[model samples]
Target: MEHLILTRDLLNTSLHQSRQIDFEIHKTAANVTRINHAFPSLEAAIRNMACKCATFGIRNHVDRALPTVSAVFKVSQVVNELGKLVSTHSASDLNLYLSLVKRFRQALTLLTNTCKLAIPWVEDVKLFLLDGTTDLGVGVDHDHPYQSNVCKTLHLLEELQGTEERSLLDQGILGVAFNKLEDEFRRLLIHNSSPLQVPSYLFSSGDEESDASDPLPPPPLPFPIVQNLRAIAVCFACDNQLDQCMSIYIKVRSTIVKASLQGLDLGYLDISLSEFDSVQEIEGYIDEWGRHLEFIVKHLLELEYTLCHQVFGQLDVWTDCFSKIALQSGIQGFIKFGNTVTKGKKEAIKLFKLLDMFAALNNLRQDFNRIFGGTPCSEIQTQTRDLIKKVVNEACEIFQDLSAQVELQRLTDPPPDGSIPKLVSFVTEYTNELLDNDYRPVLNQVIKIYSSWYDNNKFTKRLVSLEVHNIVKSLERNLVTWAKRYEDTGLSYIFMMNTSCYFSKHLTGTNLGDLMGESWIKRHQNHVEYYATLYLRESWGKISALLDNNDGDVKKRIRGFNEAFDQVYRKQSGWVLCDRGLRWETCQLILQVIIPVYKRHIQNYLALVESEVSPNKYVKYSAESLESMVTCMFQPKLDKYENSTKYTNLMGKIKNVVAGRFSPTTAAA
Candidate 1:
């Protein structure tokens, strides 16, 4: 199946190359430049190039060539005047000329959107889209393995969603269709109990004993033809570039029909689900009073109090596992895994969907009852419940174990201690368990670390870039030394170390060693630490690969952060914490920091992109996901300067550690 799918992919690539679609676009755009005699200048000629509906890929080149066109046009005007040519055109003609030029200019731009939708911090997800079964008919007449209705089902599935199939590489013209496919795919792939992780692809091992006693199942239906889906060009300004990638997608998917007609027993492969995490301010909790008001008075409305109670009990038991784990919750992206969670009453909707699935399983159970009507969910279902319980218990144990390890490290490591480092763990235990039915983990612990200053020291020990690497090692050593000197420095020193280390090691680009040096989980902080980490990734293309669009994620996370920020850091943005007035003194220093940073980078991100090239938009917007970095760090201490004077010395140390006094050349000069 993988080989067959590769063939289809190769064929599609061949088609694109042979078709020369982009090349043809380029030709057509240039052709439009010479369309009318009214284009007296080269810029005028180029600008008028997009009068006809144009693909962005081709026209964007013209847009880039505009300055040359303008120069050419200016020369052309001089030449025309030399030949005694005068302005002889109407306003309508000028409009026509400008419109054409505008088209050409529009072509030159590439729309790159930084998806900033705050993909919430999910534990893990595994969307398994492929499944299969087989039957044996080993008579003399038996030709090949009998694949039941599986192939037929796959065909029906692909055919039923043709409109959606056609729109894979494209994200426009069928937002509904695309979303529908995504939702359905998620339903098929992810389960209510766990994330949507799947088994590793089966690989043949030479000299391995075959399972002849129980013959292996027939292979899955052919791999679904899919594009890597790099980029799409669209006009974000007027939304002219419709999400029409479906057309090209449909053309490419024609291979599916051919494969089906030929009865090829191909298989399928799903992209591993991507993982990302973001920090957001927690929203307000109504506390006991609000809970009683809603749940008690509304008790009759929610008659499933018994079930609710059970669920809460279950949740309590389940949540207890994370207590020692030092686990923290953050915003989760609902529709991030090529799966869209329909917004509104989201948790309720999720439970209802689970209920629907449970109902289906119940129907299956009923069929089982008909087959062995004497059976009960108790005795026979023991295995099922055991599996669930085993998995839950095992997971809790692992969480506890992992958390304990980190806690131990935190106790042992402090600033001024030996070479201890920062670490973080992103354990997708559910994904691993569900996907690794063969019990082989797919997502292992991926670790990276780097060096830095201003971490693990009593103060913010800034160092120059030149000595930053060595100083980073020094800082690590200091942390271990400090750890040796003290008991568990939980809330005070450890918190300060974690907080200081977060700013020093993670803020700019990453340095891996610092991230993974000592206590892997307890000390880890450098892995995409921003609340909007994903949003800052790609600075290109209008159509994100649905997996990592920062633009889509940032806004969502920003809103989340804002809600949390108002209550936490800036509730009294305009006022003092102890007093009842504006904290002007502290505000000034914060502005000193905020202004410089914002001026340096804020508008770096773009709002709109009109491109005729690859689909991914050229992201103009920068520093988006840093919204948390802004509110969390900036406003809380904005006017706390008087109270924060002690940290000023630390800040100076950090500045020196991060950016030194001078280089050799400067000192010598």
Candidate 2:
């Protein structure tokens, strides 16, 4: 019975030991099970942390979320460690490694979506992804292939999500970005503000060792903001969103115009000649102004071709904007310049400068037309016309003043030679010089004004005629004084005749003849004839005194007559007789009046001195001798009166009558 009790105790002890061992094994198994189950919950915790990280990264700070992101990566590493444990323990049924991997992918997806939401712009996203804060290998070890996969997958997902989100975001906000960019440009250009600078990395030239000989870098390519805006505009265009693109284009074009015009110094337009001492200085200023305008216009045209057309693919809108600016700034500026030049005291030199300014403006207009391809702007045309009219009217006033001076001189102090000839020469020279210059365009229009006056009331024609008539009247008065100043009637008559002839001939030769009517010419001719007749009568009256038939001492009378006729012929031959007809008629009248009386006296003398020994000496008073003397009495030689039909007829009648009274064949009847 004792032996039985010992065996039972031993069995109980052994049974107790066995039961403890079994309990230890079951506790180990349960703890293993709990450890195995904790991985999924840990994955859930990691995933929750990753989601929180993504939310914080996107909503709060992306570039500054590096610590949080590092924590998430640490959690992912923990997940990776857990995954390895599952693989090492042969726990395939739980699929812990796959679950961790799948959870990590979810974390990566969250990270990628956070990046996409945080940085929408493609360029910004690229920059953010490259930034050190977003490094995916922050705490991830390469020993775990899953972590490396997560890192690479995170990058791939970022790329895919970034590309997609960028497209939608760009499409949605393209117009807004472009408009903001244009507004900034407008503010800079219109307000003349400094431009914003771009980062070197974004706009690197890659040519840091620039050639020293190269020209200054072109104005920094449009600011990066503008660059980004332009890129978006192009994207919009590609998407058939042309209206938004055009809107941006127009805004940019207007800003360019404003910028170009702002570069011009419009103060030069108000320059005054009084500020300059000489025309050359004014010309220099004008040239400088022109150069400035050219520079501005050149820049504007470059923008139109290079930027506007390339970006917007249209030219008309830009050209139209350019036209308005050109008219407003360039043409109006020149117009004001012209006004300034013409404002001061009227001087011929200043007028010429104004004319030069007008020419420059015309040339500029032509250039604009060639570049812009249209008719001259209306403002330019209108301003040009106004300038022309002002210049011409100023010239007319100057001319009128000069003409008045000439009239005053004539009225106040009439010279012996008369001022009419002086006036004629002056007017001719003035008109020729004016017409010879490059003022034809204005002069042509001026002529139309004069023509209108002529057509309306004949005012211009009458004014010209009146001026010429006044001149002639002045000449006639001076001539009358000259004629009366000389006491000798023959001398006075010769003077008057020559003077009148010259005056008439001069009138016919010059333009004045047209102004003076035909009646004036006839009146002058009559005056000349009357003077010539008076000269003939006065000159021959002395010779007629010695031809009396009743005087005693016929021989002495005939000898005295011969001596007097010789003295009178010598004295009168030197006088001027401009008209051939007047001279011939004077000679003929002298012969008619003197020859008949001389012939009668000679016949009576011969009969009275029939027995005288010196009859040949007294026979010098015959008709043939008188005819030869009278023919030689004028400036140009004249034909003998006896060669004329009237003289021959009178001689024939006299000869027939005398033959009946005395013997025709006797030396002394």
Candidate 3:
């Protein structure tokens, strides 16, 4: 079914070509009638010249040239007959019309060669036509007068300018022939075009497979089509219709080029920026935009440019032809999309996509200049360069704006379990992507040009590194502000510990880690230690200080210690340290400081502990037991309300058992 449809379409196109050719043939037939009328006058002039040659005793040479002159006139008559056949040809019988055109072209070629040969003698006739008499003296040997017949026929047409028999050979006969060639050129180009396969480099890592060193030339057109096209191009040149031929070639090839690009499913290139609701909405399109841009420039456009040289190099206008097609079909769409994205709202996520575009274009910088580099394609060159600059500037602004984005995240409440804040997590992951190998170089270029830290300053780290560091620093500063909202000084330190520890631990082995270095990790780790010390002092330090009271109220101090220990344990148990290693180390730090000191103070009250019938009230737990209790702090809280209620009820029961074991009511019972 598809084949039948395609055949119909081809038939329609051929019929159209035939009708156009038939119309031109009709115009040329009128010119042929004028040429036929001039033939009689031209033969009369040749006979008069033959008489003159006899008078000069050159009749033998003139007699020999007469047969050649007759052959030239016979070829002109054949051209006139073919013109009539072509004019009456049916559009449905296009093959016959084209065959007739081939014969007509052959006849024209023969006539043109004969004209060139007789041009010298025709100069005398041309002078005679100008003043209505021969300029050459009759006594002088009319050099090759028989050779001048073909030339005299053309000169006769010129001399009969005011007469009704004036020939329109240049504009009428050759115009029809060149028009046929033009249609054939368009037909061959359209039929031979094929959809390009997707190149690997578009999806793979940056130019790894399809390197610039391995240039891919345009695939060859069919051999028969190429020969026919070359023949047609030569004919156009011979007929002085090069401009007409080039115009048609550019128009047809440009349409095919644009259609090929559109076939890649890049319709978003034509979408307006206002159609997108958010800046991030264009991210997927931008990603595709980068891949397609690289593919088009490196493979598709490059092949078209090469193809132009292959097809049109004879006319020395291939560069101009290729430029018009490239700009019209491919490069302009890419440039428009790039410019639209640059004008989008500033966003950190958009920055990476913009960097992808920048990198794609930057990679093709040399290719662009090589392919579209001259006066004919100056608009393309200028537009692409401007788009690159806009992308860079927009990306830089968005990247630098990251610090402001970080500063604006001033949520008062941190995570409830003393875990890392969402803002901190977002910033870490965001910066990690920014420091990726693909994006880092473009970002570095952005920073080197736009970063204030890059000016006149000698720094060991790159400007991208410094900018990322500033973003990280901004996150750290925001964390401090968030940590202040936690009223429990101990939980406040835990929040800081959770954040800094997360930054140090999770970012290790990542691009951001490599940029921040070991020192950066260690510094954050030291912050965890510092926060741990402060936590131990603010929380367990006060609880351990209960044992340092030296008054004689031993039971009171023991009771006080038990209550304080229970209160702090129950409260801190619900808190969490997201990093397991940090959680363990923090728990150990509290135990090491408090357990031994409490144990030594308990030794002073051993007799009291032994005197009580039930000593578990004041001496709630042993030294080892206290260490176990403190070790369990900073674990995840209960998730279900039922479980939490059960745990609370169970703890109440345990406390009642310890309290009632030595009560007076229990002893009386």
Candidate 4:
């Protein structure tokens, strides 16, 4: 507080530039002359003031008995000097007064380190104190004074060069400034105290006429503003250290750009028969994304499949709660926060390259696919598209942060490259967790989201792009092999005609026809009811015709098909007997009994039970059955594949297997 006042007064007069000097002494002398001559510099002024300070007989004392004016007038002077350095006017005269601050800093350090006082008013103690009393303050906090003196401000490390040659950033010049500041900070740190220190050779020669090297120095007083200066210095040091952060940041930006470009260029190629939610126009089935769509579609399709997975009953309760949290709370909050950020960053995003921008978004959507599934709908795509449209930001959501970290790892060093064993090791841990942990609710959530969003019932997202291409190629090759098997041959042709006459309606369709035999649909359709009675009446006759006493294999095969059909209609959704011309939904009136018996003709009797009319309701109740039925519904689909030749050939394989196993003719002989 005392020195601040002195600094305040001197700051006004330190504005006039006298001259520049090379060495520390010349610099100090010139500024000292300014003060003695009122030369608008603090060093000259401080030297003159020190002379006057000694003449007035002022001693440095905060207590005891010295008169205010004579005991220590220089205490007020030192306060003023400190004030001047921090003052606005002294700041305005920065270049002219910098040397003065240097010298002034030196003088204070000399006085404090030497611990010697030279003043006329008090000589009682050898210490620098006015009367060398031991009292500082009864109630003052030590850190208080240091805290009060701090002044904070920003200082630029690099000033721009003249505008003429600037096309891009001048990293050379900018880097140098950062390097210098870093070096200065390192040097200061060696002293182990970050406090601003003045070098100690600037004090004036005192009362005796002595050589410049051997002079009695003028009295020195330590300045009390070290704490504030230290804080400012740290800010400078931090700026210097972080200067190189941009270099790495720009590199990360380019990698993301490259990925987005690749994905976008190939994203929309069409090879699928199904409609695409994102694409508006198409020329044939050959679009931009091409065969890659199959893998994408496959992963998407997997979302729809309800498999016999090992469910986690142990984790049901927690998993349920977490699912609710994810859907109802955390994700909702993120949606709100994310929208705000996206809105704000729209302008900045415009500056990024379109391809790079597209690539980044597509990459992110890929991550979502990993969590959710592959056939993301228009709504989900819109959400994803919105996300993609946004500019890449420095601050990230936790998920985004995690995604970035994962991508960083993938791009920087692919894990599988060096650790196939690690992958195998990881898979075991993963499998164990899924089997043993309480992931039931989470598992359900995952399935639900994946089914609804990621899976398009066509393919999985994991198989997108290149994988899709391979799959399509493999599928085409299989079709060619199938075509070769249908060439006609021998009396087997007569049996094939008989089978086709009975089953041709089942096997036929686009891809479906390629899969099943003819009459696939007719075999299962009204056969449940239309042929139920007739088939039942003839069951024993048909059984006798097909199997003799030695035909154990035929009996077993028939038993298996019977068991599968019986089990489905027997329990959960009981089968009903319905009359002809009555739709399955009108079963309440036509069908008298809901569950039917498999007494005579098991397969035919079981097929005719009518129940669900609505596809949705049917799906809800008969999902498992629908999946099974579709497995066989391909009969019509396959029937389209019908050639008497292929049928005869397949029957030949079956006949060979039966002959190898049984040879009942030999037993009879």
Candidate 5:
């Protein structure tokens, strides 16, 4: 075009030079008829030359006009094709829909570039026309004649093809497309979402090394679904409908997240405090809550978070979407259950459940913080912390209450057979379990936070030790009170021995023992020994006195000794020493005193009375028989008391035999 303009300028300059030469020639005088004839010829020649130039100009205009008109026709055709494609395809065919979106975006970019070609200056337009090298540097005038013509052509093309409505049409299309995508997203989530059963490994001992070593990333959505959703998200972002995109994402996924948790079927999550009549009623729920909490934080919420990132990572809404989903999901359900458990009846039995929950939360604290670290997730994080605190505080209260209950237990009756009391067994067993490795640290944490036990963050064994010690001491005091309830002083001693023996045995090799220390064990053992000695003194003292050499009438002494031994044997045979070693020791203690004195009193002194009075009369039991009888003592039998009649009859038959053997007539014969 610049060359054409320059050539036209040269032609015009040549014509002007020719015209001036002709005019100068005419100025020189000549014959009038010759001049007129010459003028006519020159005029004809000038006219002819002018006509040729006009013809050339017409050809030049046609040359420029043909390409412009054809280019416009081609652009119109491309616009019609794009409009038809965009209008024909349904967003349900997300693949084709996405392709159309891409094509449309490209077209828009092309139109934008076309609009930018609004260069006003002829030189700039000529430079652009020559080689397309000129930038024109930010001073393009849209109102220029050429620019307006191009825009009018474009608008005309749009009007012809209904392309002007394409944006509004595509907006409606995108709206429906996103709506369909929203449904598809929801459907895919629900269909693919299985209740992420917390893996069994997570429920393991919660060792820090184990957990850190086996760090688990949240599981991913299916590959196809992720790709599909990602494409949709990018399209929405390109179209500047990201807010609508995110709204759909958050709304659909939040519902899905909550539904997935509900599918866990932890019915206990729904149980309210008012509905729970007892601690036991809520015990199972608390266990489920702990497990469900692990599932939610480590599995379900993690999965949701990862899904959001995968689908919306290209957009800015992933974090916000995940936070909304987590809040609506049952993360709150888990935390709320903890609150309920902590606020329920503050019974000692509930402490174990509370500790279970607290321990679970403590274990998940890392995961919880990492997953819920977003600014929008503060409520969940704060509620979770508050729940843990409440659990610890409640556990401490119940533990202290348990101690008080133990101290105040006023049951007066000892166990029937002088075995361990049920109260002692329960308290010791419970304390042992509470002081276990898994639970003890949590208990200590509770005590540290809620009580004035150790007064620092350091975990001192003494904290739990003091707790167990207090519990044991309370139990011991209760034992003392209960032991006094036995009518027989010997039975009272036996009961104390049984209880102390139980305490020592139970505390021998456990966390409770480690906390209470060997001193506690030794003290209980000593109590057992003291009680045993007291039992011996109370039970066998009179029998031993009867065998003492009083130098009084030997017959009287023999008779008194026999009767006292008989009375004691009948009475003590029904008693029970639960521990086998204690039972053996008790029987041995009785025999050590009995056998030596009996052998002496009867062997030496009874010989004098033997000739006058048949020895069988005073000493019906020989030393061998006496030892056997003492061994049989303290062996518990259900029918022993009922069978006392048989014992009395046997003693009567033995005495009748003695009388027969020592009758006076038989003695004379």
Candidate 6:
């Protein structure tokens, strides 16, 4: 027992010395060189201690051999220190440092093998060796310092007796290191407070122009965060953990989207455009939000395509989130927004905004296609087109309603201007502006709607032409109704002629004119000509009928003819004949149709009257005086008539009879 106790005492002293050397080595770099010189001596002492402990029968001494256990733990401590020191060695000095490492590792192996009793503290040495081999660090750049260290350590570990143990250590250390990196990234995201916030102007003010020029603020997170994330992704991809790397990427992209949208005030998205000041305000908000979305998606796709396929394999999570977020905050929001902005607005204003909305949708679809470049935004495009169709339909409804209201007002109220109605000016201005803008899409849609109403199964040019024809017919009906409202037939014909001329001239000048075709325009012109002829027939035809000598009573006939001529002349002279060309043509027709017959009738009547007692009383005037009065029929200002050749020849014959140059028998011949 005394011999055994002395051996244990020597073993304890050597273990104490080994531990002291290890402490000295770890204490300073100056001692690392000095202590490393003492490692050979320390190795000898630990080797002797292990041999003595092995001779003591480790199993038999397990309960009472506290010193034996302390020695085993001491060897573990020494091995840990040596591994750490080896990690710091330069490549040139690595062989020398590793020589010392080899001694300590050998001592540890001998101690464990000789003891035959498992030391719970032995795990510390194994873990230290694995860590030295892996060079795993908890810091941000975990792979930087440890790369060469891990290579060297793995090379050494592979040559060791415990291949299985080294493999297990390799896996465990890699997992822990990767997990540390993941946790750090997670903490970074959790702590990031740079989510975009809604601008105060978006919700608080109604100034569209002010908002339109408002510059978009930069994203909440700095550029470095993105760089760091990408670095981590690259590292994971390098490690062949692409799935895990993709997951991180997905999380990062989601966070970016979330941050951007947080500033958009998504709750206000459901608000109608009327809640704001104007369509421009809604446009500003949508554009602002769209810019942010565009920025994020652009960067994301750039990052994605730039990465290798192995790193970014058909990642849809980012795109899916983008689509959802953008639609929720932009397109869907605009549906109600469009309605509210256009609501209660003037028809022209409503048409402008709705068409502008369609333009915006077209631009957005193009942007989406340009950015995503695949089927990613296909659904969004389809939805956008559907929204455009809805806006177009709404615009058509507004147009139809405006037309109805104008027609209603025309029917219910007299012309405020007392000439052509205001509806003409309104329709004229509206159509001119519409065509001037070249809104062919709006025209096409309107035509489509009208065609659908006419015949759903057939959408031909004929049907569209018929629709236009119907619109003209409605106008004609309105004009005729307006004209007939006046009691005087001559005045009524003048009103119809004037209104029809104005309508036909304006329609022919517009794109609506093109759609109506040349034939339609000619039809309208013919209608104007028919009205002019009707005016002549009503006013001048009565006077011409009095020129007939059908009545046997010459005195009654002359009295009646004189009365009718005076009545027609007074009524026509007071009327407004607006068009100069129409008035001239009307004057020519009256002179041509009535002059010769009037000359013959007056010659017959005056021949009988010339023999009476009171010839002057019997005949109202001489033939020349009657000719002068007849010439003044349509001339309100005594403007000279430039009669055609036929009118000149006819007027000459009448003049000859009135001047007594031709006998009544000769004039009749």
Q: Which candidate number has the best lDDT? A: 3
Tens-digit lDDT string for candidate 3 (400-460): 6778766666534567667766456556666777777767877776555544433543323
Clashing pairs in 3: none
Q: What is the TM-score of each candidate against the true structure?
A: 0.16, 0.37, 0.69, 0.21, 0.66, 0.44
- Give the C-alpha miss distance for residue 176 in model 6, angstroms: 18
Give the TM-score comparing model 4 with the true structure, all chains together: 0.21
lDDT by residue (tens digit), candidate 5, 1-669: 433453465457545644553443243222223433443343344334334435433223323433443443445345445644654555557788778767765664554333333212222322332333323223325664433443444343333234233443324333434444544554454455444433444344332223445446446567887888888878777767677667766765665556555555666776777423445666656666666677777777777888888988877778888888787776777777777776676655667777888778888988988878888788887898788777777777677666676655554455655666545545665676776676788887777776554345654657677767887777778778877787888888888887777667756776666677798789989998898888878878777887786868877887888888888778766677766677778888888977888888887765676567456676778889988998877665542222221121222232222222122221111
Q: What are the root-mean-square deviations of the candidates from the true structure over C-alphas?
A: 42.5, 30.2, 12.4, 29.8, 21.6, 20.4
lDDT of 4 by residue, 1-669 (tens): 323443453334222211111232254344434433331232233334344445333223212212322212343245235423422122223333334444444444343322223222123211222222334323223243311111000000001111111211222212222333333333222222211111122122222332446433221111222222233233333334332322221222222223223433332221221211211122211222212232222222121111101111122222222222223212222223233333322111111122222333344455456433323233344554454433233111211222222222221211111111111112122222222223222323333333454356433332222322332233233322322333322112211222222222323332233323245435534443443333223322233333222345433434543454345333313111111122232222212221122122233323433443532321122324433442331122112223322232222232222221112221111
Residue-level lDDT tens digits of model 6 in 1-669: 433453465457545644554454355334335434443443344345335445433322222333444454455456456545443442223235335444544654654442343332232223332353432222213243223332322222222224113312322223322443454444444454344434445444333433555556554345565545445554445445545555554455445445555555555446554422434334445544434334334433333333322233343334543444344334445455545555433433445556555555554555556544446556656655565566657666655554444345434433422245534444444444454444545455554654575548354535434543454455556666677677777777776665666556656656567765788778767877888788778887777787675866767777787888777776666564444555566666777777777677767777877767877675675656765665554432422222211121222223232222112222211
lDDT of 6 at 162: 40
What are the clash counts of all predictions, listed in order? 111, 0, 0, 86, 0, 2
For model 1, residues 53-137, the per-residue Cα lDDT tens digits are 1443324433443443344334333322221111112112333433332342232221101001100100000001111121111
lDDT, model 6: 0.48
**Count of backbone collisions within predicted model 4:** 86
TM-score of 3: 0.69
Worst 10 residues of 5 by lDDT: 660-669
Clashing residue pairs, candidate 5?
Answer: none
lDDT of each prediction vs. the true structure?
0.26, 0.47, 0.66, 0.27, 0.62, 0.48
Query: lDDT of candidate 5?
Result: 0.62
For residues 542-619, write the lDDT of model 2, one tens digit per residue.
Answer: 667776745668777788788878887777665545445656776788787778778888888788877878867767
Ranking of all candidate structures by their TM-score, best first: 3, 5, 6, 2, 4, 1
